[model samples]
Target: MKIVTWNINGIRTFRGGIKKALDSLDADIICLQETKVTRDLLDERTAIVDGYNSYFSFSRGRSGYSGVATYCKDSATPFAAEEGLTGLLTNHEGPVRCYGDHTEYSTEELQLLDNEGRAVITQHRIMCQDQVKTVTVINVYCPRADPEKPERKQFKLQFYKLLQGRAEAILKDGSYVIVLGDINTSHRTIDHCDPSDIDDFEENPGRKWLNCFLHSDKQEEESTDEEYNEAYKLTSTHDGKFVDTFRHFHPTRTNAFTCWSTLTGARQTNYGTRIDYIFADCQLAEEQFVAADIMPEVEGSDHCPVWGQLSCSLLPSSKNPPLCTRFLPEFAGKQQKLSRFLVKMDQKSIQSEQRNELPGSQEEEERRENLNPSGAGKKRVLTAESIIPKGKKTKTAKAASKPQGSLLTFFKPKITNVLPSTEAPERQKNLDQDEVTSPQNPSVKGSVTKDATLVLDGSEQLCTSSYPKDNDQGTKVKTPHLTSQPTVGPSDTKKGASSGFWKSLFHGPPPPPPCKVHGEPCVLRTVKKEGPNMGRQFFVCARPQGHASNPEARCNFFAWVDKGK
Candidate 1:
């Protein structure tokens, strides 16, 4: 199967281009980024790609902004909105209620306050026809460059961390995973058209974003400055993980970039760096890895599509093949033609060999003797004894070149370390030496700073009362003074506030209590006693009186939860 990933820039304006890509490329699965249209705004009629099931994960944007969509061919269903990395549901708490102040702010500010919701990364599990194999595909579009504003850069880094966590979890299943989309960070210098132009100073907003992603843990001890610099050279500052796929398919050719600027018009020259990528597990690399750009003539998005094909086998006892893959339209016809040609060539070769060995009549032998008078007259003497040359004994060059030993043996290319340039000393002098520690408030770690201290008081009533109220004119008011107070302990503060203010402030709402009907000691187990779904243990009412038939049930509650082993 072949899968293609492309950032359609804006689906609305480029719907025709997208259609053309789908028609000409014939991707079995197409992962699109920056769709820029919400579910409600999408024109389904035009969005439809014939012979493929479509799924879209649009960002919560109105006009031009981030969004992603995927198209899958075959029985494999596109992830529903609730499934897949892009669709994970994030429950964002409403803005913290600030108490004791009334300040003027605009309706836009009020809307900003309302935008404090969390996002959940959706995960989709695609099961191929053969149930034995499955693969998970994620589409992401990280935040872009905006130096004047640093928050967008920070958001991009944070988004990558979240995406990494999600990816690690999905990989735990041991299934072939393919993550495609505009990751936003260029992993190396080769990934960018102009790497020298990238500013590495602290004031350079993009540099901070790059540093955040490349050094997520801030572990200065783990990586040398040179190592980090080399990583940067291999990755684009615009999108940091360019070398990630290279590491997966090591010893292979390295330059496989997808995104290029049309303004440059350098497509024919191949001068552009690779931005988009298709990353897969090493196990699936051989049978399922391929990447190439869609033609620039395809007037679609600024970015072209890159695709990969996967192949796997199944045994008689196996219910399904051991792999599930997405396909590309560009490869389908070519693959079929190649397979047909191979079979025909094999048959023709076999027929020719058989005809050569057929018994000849006396007339035919005489005709052959006339054609080769010297051979017929002499007792077909052997002029020379053929001997297998040392390396030529093997049919292919690769086989001849390989030394006999374990198949795992491989030639490691010698790597030379290049010294840093003379400008490095000046660049080091300009770098910031101070490290920014996490704020005293843990809540602020993953939240916006302006409202970080809002819910210090643990009392639910005080928390609710603190929220700015709407005045008689129906305009919402802000309480700037309330946020001005220095940090104070719960004991030193006013009465009726809970002592665990820090905990209460960040915890948001409480989760539902465990079901009493299931009782205290319910054991979970995986068993295949009943049927295909039987092994999965679901929470059941442990209380005898809580049984469904019992009218006097002590607790009529039972909630199912996965106690992952």
Candidate 2:
């Protein structure tokens, strides 16, 4: 069965994108990241296909934040591990009490909050028709590099540890585990467009975070320096424990990147990187794998969908049997004869038409001579008399006598010019006589003025008046209000003198309260310097705006805000 993973950005915003992906790929299983929607917001019909079952886990943050969902074609449920452990750990405190004597908790009460305050891990167990047991798929979106301070390094490491523990538990189960979705990490020099441009030695919290999974066993031996950091172990570990589906499936392909730079609009160019991935268990390596770079054609999302297929045996009972039937001899013979007769008729008609129109033939010369007779003795032949059937002559004569133009167009101007003065005024007078009519007109008119009401009504009535007569007995005629004309004001005249003052003060919503660093607001506005990136306003730390005394107190909490732009 085909399986696909995609970071859908926001489910509501990119709902169409999800639908498009599903229609194009038709995958049996789909894992989506950053759905940013709770169960209440999902459309049952649009989000879940008729025969498929879906499960979703939302982030603890407010609406429009990190969330993940999985859609399976067959019967499956969310994998609920033992001990209230939802295969994810967060920075927030765990449950103080247990529901039952057993350490295991129900999936209904399980919660997996994001510890790094970045993203949550959502896992789904899909049962294939092949009865190949359960396939656990985990969707992940990791934290990004924070420029506010250096404390993010520690938090990133902790987040990775939590993920590693979950992975180990899943693998120990001995089922086919597929860790897919946007891992938000790129390994190897080929994964990035310009790997050398950025300093590899610089402290990157996200890179360190990925190392937790890539170098789980050798974390102590790996160098702390980002340059020497071999967390992903591009050469060995991937092939051993996990399989990089893209590299393994499409080895000869180059520039097979998923995430693209929205600013440049180029496919796998300078700013493009392969941050999205689909990692499969080593056991499934022999099964044929396929990875498609769908970034070039699709729009809306920064990361494109990556899909793979696994060949597995289906259970005998699941296979559908062919239907058995027979055709009647009499009906079959009649159908065959009808088909042959039509084909012969078509061929005969084609030959007859061709022979009649042949050039230099007797029939062609005679037809030409009849059309252009040059002899003085030749009489003017009336072709119409010969061509017209006996009784049709009277009908044709009557049709020729009538005017060629349509009846509606012939008297259009006259009808329009006469109706308004004669019928419209009386009809409007009768309408105004009833108090109920004007009130109903207001509801129909919406925000339109009286003149607009009259004009629209007159156009519908096909009135041709240059100036309609005022039918109201008490009201006086007034000039029509032109909505497009600018209103002159005393304040508008003074604004020219104080333009600079207003321009300086009006800097668009005061920069979104500054990004918080270490639980306090930071002064630096990254959005002002960087411009709009996605729909977020990024910020760096300046002097601490609140509790922190040292302006340099580093913290990973410095983040971007949506601000409802």
Candidate 3:
């Protein structure tokens, strides 16, 4: 499962980036901070995406102030939602003082951080291994302390303390926790573009706010009307119930910023701060990380999208065949394993022998003159005009029978499927008619083409991918090459242990299926339909060598893809 946390700055203006993130990364959940739009002003487009459920917490007492929103993919569900600091509202010290403003807020307003909707927590049910567990994701748009206003700065600190306490309380309920969003505090100097850009360190309360959460300055402070927040804690600690996911993975890394200041032109100059983050519990952080990267390309917001993938024990789709894989009878057994290069070689050898020696009969006299321009029989042809109905031109074959139960791969080869390269060589789009017939509305008899979408995978069958390169740098972005035509045949054996698996998977078009009746090769054919069997591919019987068409040709046996695998 992939999760993305991005400070969109404002939902009204930033939804475009949300769409791009969804399309580009296919994240499971997207947490947006500083969504300035309220429910009343939220248009239909902003409230919902076609395949996701959206939840939002709009700011109170203002049209556009502070807000947070979470988008959950259709596959996941959020069972509960809590707005603001919930019970923490009653635990505040008292009414606080601000720098410039003399006016003091009431206890309720101060506790709730002026009802700006800085946070919202949603509980999602996730399937982990064999059991179902809950994950509470708290999306927070923590207030940024205003340099000119002392009250806002104090409120920001208060909000931070409340958020930390609430997160701890949620953990007590036994659910995995992911506290995500724009915390609005640069925890370290490396978090921002440059350390020298910072101003006051000792007198700055906002600077102290981040250090407080990072488990620094652990000395006990004297108690007074002002209650100082506790020292920072790690996700594994009871006191520090959250792990900074990014920082944990890249402890010493620098120059990874999530938010930029447009007014100061920080983004243009690459001088921004990494304020937004996805903080999770220790267990999830340690064992479930799949990828952690800042998507600098996603546009339409002051802050770029930051996303990470986790191999959570949810669905087992990652281990199964690709969702697009399908089966057809024309490619049964030996049919899909035949290498195109090998087939051409075999055909070339047969053509030369036939051209040098003529048949000894009148029946051979008719077949002697080479019908194909390529000096070879187009393919191992097999089909009886008598067996085929007089008027019908095409046949629709059903898929191979499903296994008795769910397929559990006992010895399935562990091949690292690589994403295709963008600069792959280009070639013709259409499959050669003689090599692999194109299935049409009125399909004619021919060998099933390698380009058909039908895919059959059994214990011994090979499954190939066009993209075979490794990406050690990070998570790989899948290329469009595999979905295109197969350009290269299987590569020769390689150095790694998985080299054999790679060889099998990257093989060319297979030889025709074996005929059960006459031990001849069954010619593969494609079945095209406007309905379910659009990409169907399979094979029919081709008479064996030295055998011409006869009245009794029962060798034309038909089978579904990989039926004998």
lDDT of each: 0.43, 0.46, 0.54
The predictions' CA RMSDs to the true structure, in order, are 39.0, 27.1, 32.6
| 74-128: candidate 3 lDDT, tens digit per residue | 6654555555664332222221111122134344644456266677666666676
Please name the candidate that would achieve the greatest TM-score relative to the true structure. Answer: 3
Cα deviation in Å at residue 191, candidate 3? 0.9
Residue 61 of model 1 has an lDDT of: 19
lDDT tens digits, residues 370-414, model 2? 111112112223343455886798787877795344433322222
Off by over 4 Å in 3: 14-21, 87-107, 200-207, 212-239, 313-565
Clashes of each: 46, 2, 21
Question: Candidate 2: global Cα-lDDT?
Answer: 0.46
Q: What is the Cα root-mean-square deviation between model 2 and the actual structure?
A: 27.1
Assess every candidate by TM-score: 0.41, 0.46, 0.47
In terms of lDDT, the best-performing candidate is 3
Model 2, position 336: C-alpha lDDT score: 47
> What's the CA error at residue 428 for candidate 2, in Å?
45
Ranking, lDDT, top scorer first: 3, 2, 1
